[model samples]
Target: MTDEPLADLALSRSSLDRVALERRRSEVLSELLEDPRTRVAEIRGDRMQVVDPGDRAAPTAPGAPSAAKASGQDASRACSAGALGLVLRAPQPEDRERLVLHLGRDGDGTAYVGVVSPGPHEDPAQPGWLTLRQAGEALTRRDAGLFTTGLALANWHATHRFCPRCGAPTEPTEGGWVRRCEREGSDHYPRTDPAVIMSVVDPDDRLLLGRGAHWPEGRFSVLAGFVEPGESFEAAVAREVAEEVGITIDAARYLGNQPWPFPSSVMIGFAATTRQTELTVDPVEMAEARWVTRGEYRDLLREGTVRTPSGISIAKRIIEHWLGDTVESVTGGTSPRW
Candidate 1:
């Protein structure tokens, strides 16, 4: 197995400075909004505005040259040929009425904020608006971070408007990072559920793969499950493998992790080894489970028989770690998506 950590897990990349201390200042958001140097990323539903590097039709808001510079748009033409970038503009007056999130700052010290619309204000089928899954692999590192952080914050705020302890309405504070209950004044922060995704290998060097219940045929990826309360990640890995595939893993090694903000999750990855590989599958969680050697896996990809996980997923990176090469390198083409 490769000793090096998995490289370039999508959604894990970020160039932003997160200036977490700035979130504590009461005047920070006001000051940033007053200055046109602050760039605003608007989030509507699960989508954000994305634009091609060469597309000049989307004009920057007034006094936004600094905003554009901070967003790396000036140098984006030299980026990957078909790469997309976030559409950042000067803050609007209505942003104060919406859910405003103090995202972070770029290396240039220019701040970025996210304004969440109550609903999809624009047409969902519009060409420029895209969810993170659709545009993550194509966006620059900074934009990916902005979108992931913004979406996660937005989803949290949407679901957590009321305090659990007092059953009281909460108001956003701490630059939108914390919500305080109106009655009890208790603070609530964003929550990230931890899930373990693993590549389970048997003694013969075969990798275990399973298709989730109700997943389409030919769609398979490694086993994964939420980390139960009071359980370590390694323990969760072993338990999930056993519960899903009826196999007891002897040992599990840390691989890597990535922010998976599909409604809010951080996927912790692992590589597990097992001596027992009996074919007993759980019907509730998984439809099928099988072990495949590297050669067999490659052949399945070449024949388009098995669909891989999403390109922006830690599962894909974990699979590549076990395969010793990218799926594209094996298939010599774009991977068949699940």
Candidate 2:
């Protein structure tokens, strides 16, 4: 593939400056929350509210200044029409009781924080509330980074409420970046599991695709699996291909990586070449496996015989890399949701 494909991976684009040293300041979260200049993104479940960039009052609290006003920019000129931005507001008094994360700072030194609610949004059916999968492709680089980081941290806090060493409850500290054990005094940080997703190719330049054991019939994407203990990404790639499809790859090349926080994982991508062309599918892991040439895959997509992966996924980009054109170019429609 080329650098353009790797650069276009949706979840990999982030412009926030994660001032790590600032996260260490005592009472920093409190200070930022008190400042009206700080920008706060509210997350409920996996969704955050989105607004058209051209809308001036929609993204702010009832009485507070909008993000553009706080940052000294003209809201009308902030972005083109039809583009989306996060609904950031001035922090509320109740935010102190919720899980607040210090996302990062913009280039202008304006702080950004995320406050997560305990349950789903009050009105999920409301027009603007959307999850990362639905909004990531449309959001600005900074908002995308904020949403991705905030959701990943919130997921970690949700599942790691107790200390692994002594079974004690943990409390958030260090701007919600670390959790300290109430009993043992041990500190825990956020966790991200690493998985490898790869496009496997045979000598004939045919791309390998598979449907998961539980996936519906028409949906298919590249094979992916978690990296095991004491294994490199390349080794994981080879093992995943061998275990899932019974093919040994001769070589593997790194393409790129992106955060996939469906639960919690960072997906590393690779392209592998193999000489074997045989049929052996692991029934427990895959429902079906097949090799498709560039022409055949295009026909499958154009005919609506196969569904592509989610638009925000690296799997889609990897498949696009192997196919040498986008699925939309062949199908004349947006990528289908899986």
Candidate 3:
């Protein structure tokens, strides 16, 4: 059978094809870098700049219009989502950015990558760094795709600078996609941990949301956990729910997934059904667990007591899907799906 309906999760849409063969050729990557048509998305720390376009939607108060509806700008902005504050015009090689990678080509066949470079921003002013979480929904499909891929590559480069097998530092290779150890002659590719986040529903259709021990007060969303070695995505869903909330999931179905590149992980979303409604929250895993009906979920949102995940997250999408309506997000923005 076909997979369950997918949700409109952020960082899910991409316009690049990641020309793998071209990236393999150092000469080709270098040539592309020098091409005047090529563009770069600059990443500093975890933030990228959203290209500010005239007539673009102005940044609104966090709780103003739904962040989802914040679209409807110039066609150029939509086509070049990468232009969000983070994208840079064509730069000469002298920029000498520390980290760079070949992302892929856009619909117009213009190649784009990410880099650490200078921009129009005057030292953290109006056009400053936008966190990926904050910018994902606001970005064009191309921009979101480029940012997520670039961030994941950049984060890997930052952390995997050392060879694990030998006590030696590795160097970036393969267009910033692989790390090779001089001592061991080993190649390490970027790592993406597979995580499962699920919306668990009981017979009454109440959605299961839990607050992690460290999450802010009243914050709750669906349960999520990393996939263990040798565990399938479906199995991980069942195991995580049981481990976190002591509920036995009777059936699990695949939904969709999004790349959560906060540090490199793909969140596989699922909708699950569980017979056991009783929650025995694991002190080590979560602070509290509750099954909230649609009415109660709306009431909690109305009372400003419950906070859900951001509009861009898969958790928020699944939760909204199950709630059968767009519950006012605590983040004060409309979800991208609506």
* lDDT by residue for model 1 (1-338), tens: 69788877779888898888889998888888888888999899988878766762444553333212112222222223227778888877877788899989988888999989886455656556777877787678898899999999999999999999989999999899999999999999999999999999999999999999999999999999999999999999988988888889999889889999989999999899999989789999999999999999999999999999977888888898889988888887576785
Shift of residue 304 alpha carbon in model 2, Å: 1.0
Instruction: Give the candidate order by descending lDDT.
Output: 1, 2, 3
User: Model 3, stretches more than 4 Å misplaced?
Assistant: 1-4, 55-86, 117-126, 328-338
Q: Put down candidate 3 lDDT per residue, 158-206, tens digits, no spaces.
A: 8888998886999877777889998888999999999999999999988
User: Against the unseen true structure, what C-alpha lDDT does each candidate score?
Assistant: 0.84, 0.83, 0.74
Over 263-289, each residue of candidate 2 has an lDDT whose tens digit, in order, gives 789999999999999969999999999
RMSD of each predicted structure = 4.2, 4.7, 6.6
Give the per-residue Cα lDDT of candidate 3 at 275: 83
Once fitted onto the true fold, the runs of candidate 1 whose alpha carbons sit more than 4 angstroms away are 60-82
Best-to-worst ranking by TM-score: 1, 2, 3
